[model samples]
Target: MKILPFVALTATLFSSGAAFATEQTVTLNVANATCELCGPIVKGSLSKVSGVLDVQISEADGAAIAKVRFEDSRTNVPALITATTNAGYPSRIVQ
Candidate 1:
């Protein structure tokens, strides 16, 4: 009986890979965010994406830096890039 329970636990852990999903944070460069209105638009777009947990935009010079946290299983860096670009903000991963 003890051996059977241990085998079942091991199998369960391997079967649902997504259950171990982790959060990821990325910084993006928003090149066109030179004005006050730009930050809100960029933030709104990022906030609307599914699995996006948080978004923070900081402006400096003529650009905006966006830090975003999201669940890796539901979204990714490419999706984040697309969101801002579609909003007319035009962003790229910082690294």
Candidate 2:
């Protein structure tokens, strides 16, 4: 049997495969963030974490949505959550 060409295989793989490293929207549920007071602290904390691109914390919902551009190699969700928690508000990965 003849083998499939390398270029064709490569194209198929790219079309079908899930992206490993890409900008992803992850929502964070935060505890104890209930006022404008909590906003800047959450923003600063998340900013310190490596590989974070965009962060938006809402005191109304007590949540933070981050547009994170990170390599699983450079950083991860757990680490980011820990950073938020350490800053003050307890946070968990919601998405």
Candidate 3:
């Protein structure tokens, strides 16, 4: 029927839009993370954020770096930074 074709077209269009969604990775420099336990805290904070796929924490140059991978459609860099900051680890994007 004509309606069936219309429904199929609509489904295809919506599904195709989802295909454009991208996963982004960014490293955040957490200035307040100064101890060994800080890594887990930072990772936990980032993991709690919606759309965060993965979080890796490492120390470099006396600062903690949190590497985060997330779905761009659901979260952005600012949200990630806010999450860490709210958890007492204020951070900025590593250039």
lDDT of 2 at 68: 42
Candidate 2, residues 10-70, lDDT tens digits: the string is 7877775434555555677778777766778887887787767777766546554444445
Q: Which candidate number would show the highest TM-score if scored against the true structure?
A: 3
lDDT of each: 0.93, 0.69, 0.90
- Clashes (candidate 3): 0
The CA lDDT at 49 in model 2 is 78
User: What is the per-residue lDDT of model 1 for residues 28-52, given as tens digits with 9 covering 90 to 100?
Assistant: 9998899999999999999999989
Between prediction 2 and prediction 3, the one with superior lDDT is 3
> Which residue pairs clash in candidate 1?
none
lDDT of each residue in 1-89, candidate 3, tens digit only: 87999999889978766666799999899988888998998899999999899999889876799889999988899999999999998
True lDDT of residue 42, candidate 2: 80
Candidate 1 at residue 58, lDDT? 99
Task: Report the CA-based lDDT of candidate 2 relative to the real structure.
Answer: 0.69
Note the clash tally of each candidate. 0, 0, 0
